[model samples]
Target: MKILGIDPGLRVTGFGVIEKQGARLAYIASGTIRTPDGDLPQRLKSILSGVGEVIGTYRPDCAAIEKVFVNVNPQSTLLLGQARGAAICGLVQADLAVAEYTALQVKKAVVGHGKAHKQQVQDMVQRLLSLSGLPGTDAADALGVAICHAHSGDALKALQAFAPALGGKGLRMRGGRLVG
Candidate 1:
């Protein structure tokens, strides 16, 4: 499966593509889209177009994105959410299924800890993907999002596959486990 991951930001959105085969992951591409400073709408347009271009080029089977966290500044958080919305619009326009992950979830998946710093994530991404060098912070985060999905998506599917059976038993999944 090919997965596209996005780390959306108003100024610099990052993207990464990877192919997963069996238990291994191979990096395909990683980069940042820097929107030129100016009007907010234009910058958003750039992000939308950039993401569309990526989907067109990579043609991923699905996509994963980092969810926007509430910032200390409400305005900043709102703008970040807008950027994320633009990215989601692009993905859905291409008919791709999108999964969302929080920064804490991404960090835990990539670095084995939620409190890992950016450098730790970059290093772990490099090691996991067998890259020759570290990716930029933004790109690393995007790749981390993809890596997180690659690790967890199969388990999610497995759990979902049992949903009907569990439902027959008056049970369901909650907090990543079966419950009644």
Candidate 2:
């Protein structure tokens, strides 16, 4: 399964693509969409267009995005949420199923701990994907989200949801087993 992971931000949105086969993950591509200094609307448009292009080019089977964490400043959190909204719109427009994961979840999946540092996440992502060099911070976060989703046992179900337009509706679990 091919998954595109997104780490959305106002100034720079990061993207990573990975293919999962059995228990292994292969890196396809990773990069950042750096928006120039501009107004809020322009930044959001850049995020939407940039993410849409990534989806079009990669043609991923599904997508997973990092959820916006509320910051100390409510304003910052709101802006981040807007950027996330634009990213999600891109995925929905492409008819791709999307999964959302918190930052702690992503870190725990990649680094085996919820509070791992940036360098730790970067190091783990490189090791897991067998990359020779460290991915930048934002790109590594995106890849971390992809890795989290891959380990999460949801890729097939996510793709299945797309065919039926189910999105998040089909899967539920109870008592350690799938319920829907």
Candidate 3:
């Protein structure tokens, strides 16, 4: 499966594309979209168009994006959310299923720890995708988000394979847990 990941920011949005074949992942592309200093709406338009162009170029089967975390400054958090929303709009417009991952979840999936620093994540992402060099911090985080989705996608498929049996038992998975 081909996957595209996005790390949305008002100033700089990062994007990465990878192809997953069973247990292996191969890097396809990674880069950042820098918006000029200007009005908020224009910045968001840049993000939306930038993301759409990436999607068109990569044509990923699915996409994953980093979720916006609440920042110390409420305004900053709100702006980040807007950027994320623009990315999502692009993905959905292309009829892609978008999975969202938190920074902690992405770090744990890529680096095996939630507290890993940026360099650690870049190192792990390089190792995982067997890249020749380290990706930029924003691009690395976007790749991490894609990696997380790849891992979780396997688990979700496994669960789906057993859905029929679980349904017979009047049980289901709710939010990653079994419920009866």
- The top-ranked prediction according to TM-score is 3
- Model 1: per-residue lDDT, tens digit, 1-180? 999999999999999999999989999999998999999999999999999999989999999999999999999999999999999999999999898889999999999999999999999999999999989999999999999999987666666677677654444446646565
Cand. 1 Cα-lDDT: 0.93
Q: Write the per-residue lDDT of candidate 2 for residues 86-144, one digit (tens) a residue.
A: 99999999999998889999999999999999999999999999999999999999999
Question: How well does candidate 3 match the true structure in TM-score terms?
Answer: 0.92
lDDT of 1 at 35: 95
lDDT of each: 0.93, 0.91, 0.91
Cα distance off (Å), candidate 3, residue 109: 0.5
How far off is residue 124 in model 3, in Å? Answer: 0.2
With a 3 Å backbone cut-off (N, CA, C), the pairs that clash in candidate 2 are none
Model 3 spans > 4 angstroms off: 162-180
**Tens-digit lDDT track of model 3 for 5-55:** 999999999999999999889999999989889999999999999999999
> TM-score per candidate, in order?
0.90, 0.87, 0.92
Model 2 spans with C-alpha error above 4 angstroms = 154-180
Global lDDT of model 3? 0.91
lDDT of 2 at 33: 91
Best by lDDT: 1
